[model samples]
Target: MTLEEYKKEFTEDDAVGWLEIDKEFDRLYPDQEPKHYAPPISYMLGGEYPLDGVSIYESKKQTDHFHFVTYGFSELYYNEEKVNGEFSKWGFELTFRLKPFEGDNGNPPSWAVALLQNIAKYVFSSGNWFEEFHFMPANGPIRLETDTDITALVFVNDPEIPKKQTPHGEVTFLQITGITSAEYESIKDNPGTAEELVNKLRENNPLLITDLNRK
Candidate 1:
């Protein structure tokens, strides 16, 4: 859209960018109400967490799994001055695909929300951004207090969601996929091999869903 049109539409609408994100999800899941988790008070008003919210959606694309998407990583509010920039705040948001475990009962677990928030806290504090093939050790089981061996994470572009252009800027969805302890060791020292590892992972798991029970 033209800059003049953008100003006319979003001059006073603070949720211009937010609505764009919702539009994408709405197209993919019409009439679906995602399970949303947000801080009691917003971070702008001194909430402990940096992320504004995370939404969990039920998916059965390749298998039954929960799709978690994060808000607040980018410029979710309207700012007239930043309209000409090449990218929004960070130019990207975080996403995750998680397979349901035995006790999930068709609902996303609280630990998953906490995990996303913790990652957001790191980005907000450290000014670091995640990219495809980048990996991190979760220090222990990704699901805390669980016996699962999925102890690491690696990033890739989400297969289903493509980058979008909003009046604010461009946004990319970076999917965070979990990895096992052995998989972590294989790529920790050799970051260049991360892509290769992901390819190997996809041989059996096409969607690269994070399965906590899998060894």
Candidate 2:
């Protein structure tokens, strides 16, 4: 929306951005209730987690996996000062798709929740943000203490959720996909290899679901 248009519709307690996100997800999932995780206190009040919350959905695209989308990375609430801005807080929120592991029994793993929180903590603390094809090392197994080869991450735009422009700004759903140690090293060996690796992964796994069993 243009600045003039925004001014014409502005409200002090307007939750335009937040409601837009919810409306998109509601369209996708219909009547399903997603599993949501959030810290007890709000981040503005110095809560432990940087994100306001994460909502997880069971997706059957390509394979059965849990889809995690974050909140609090953007200007979720209304603010006249930021009307019709180009981008939200950092212009994006993190998303992840993880294949169901053994013993999940239809329940999304807790580690996924913790992983998002750690990523948010890093961004909120270091004032750094991630973008398409950016890769990072987890320093250990992504699922710590577990015998897994997925120890790193690479980002890409979420295939399912398209970017949306709200009254506050535009928000991109940046998806985080886990990778193996060999894959991580290969990216490091060749500075721009992450995009290539992600392309290869998409050949067989279009959704880029992070499978702990992957090697």
Candidate 3:
């Protein structure tokens, strides 16, 4: 979207951005009450981090993977000046579909939230943004105490939803898909190998849940 377009959008309503994002998610999920967390203070005003809050939703029917979404990244608060750019803040918020490991409680581990917060810190402090087909290493196994083999992550557009344009800018739902250490190295060795990775993943799993045990 152009700068002028974004300006006019906010001029019309000034809330069509983040409000639309919330409405979209609510429409998709219906009336499910997901576990929610919000910092007492916003990072923009000197709190913990950039994301104002995060929601963790566990499917009662499925009970395997958790859906995580961040609120602070995409114009969570009204700021006409900040939303004037091409990308609203970081352009997108992060989402993760994670599996509950063995011996885990119904609640997701605290580490997952910390990981997401750290990523937000990186973007807010570094001024870098993420996009689809962008993959990065978590340095080690994503689950620190777990004996999981998955050590990397790749970014892709969330399969269930498409990108949306907000008054702030365009907000895309960026899902974090875990990859094996070997697969991570392979991508680093050859940058354009994501196509092959996607094809291999599509052989059995479609949602691409982060399977720590996947070989």
Output the lDDT of residue 19, model 3. 70
The reply for model 3, stretches above 4 Å from the true place, is: 1-16, 60-63, 82-85
How far in Å is the alpha carbon of 88 misplaced in model 2?
0.5
For model 2, residues 72-139, the per-residue Cα lDDT tens digits are: 78888877777778888888988899998884666788888889899989998999988899989999
Candidate 3 per-residue lDDT, tens place, 2-66, comes to 55765655564445555766676687678877787777787758897667778887643333688
Top candidate (TM-score): 1
The Cα local distance difference test for each model comes to 0.86, 0.87, 0.75
Q: Poorest 10 consecutive residues of model 3 by lDDT?
A: 9-18
Error of 3 at 9 (Å): 10
TM-score of 1: 0.95
Model 2 misplaced regions, further than 4 Å = 2-4, 7-10, 103-105
Candidates by TM-score, descending order: 1, 2, 3
Per-model TM-score versus the true fold: 0.95, 0.93, 0.85
Which pairs of residues collide in model 1?
A: none
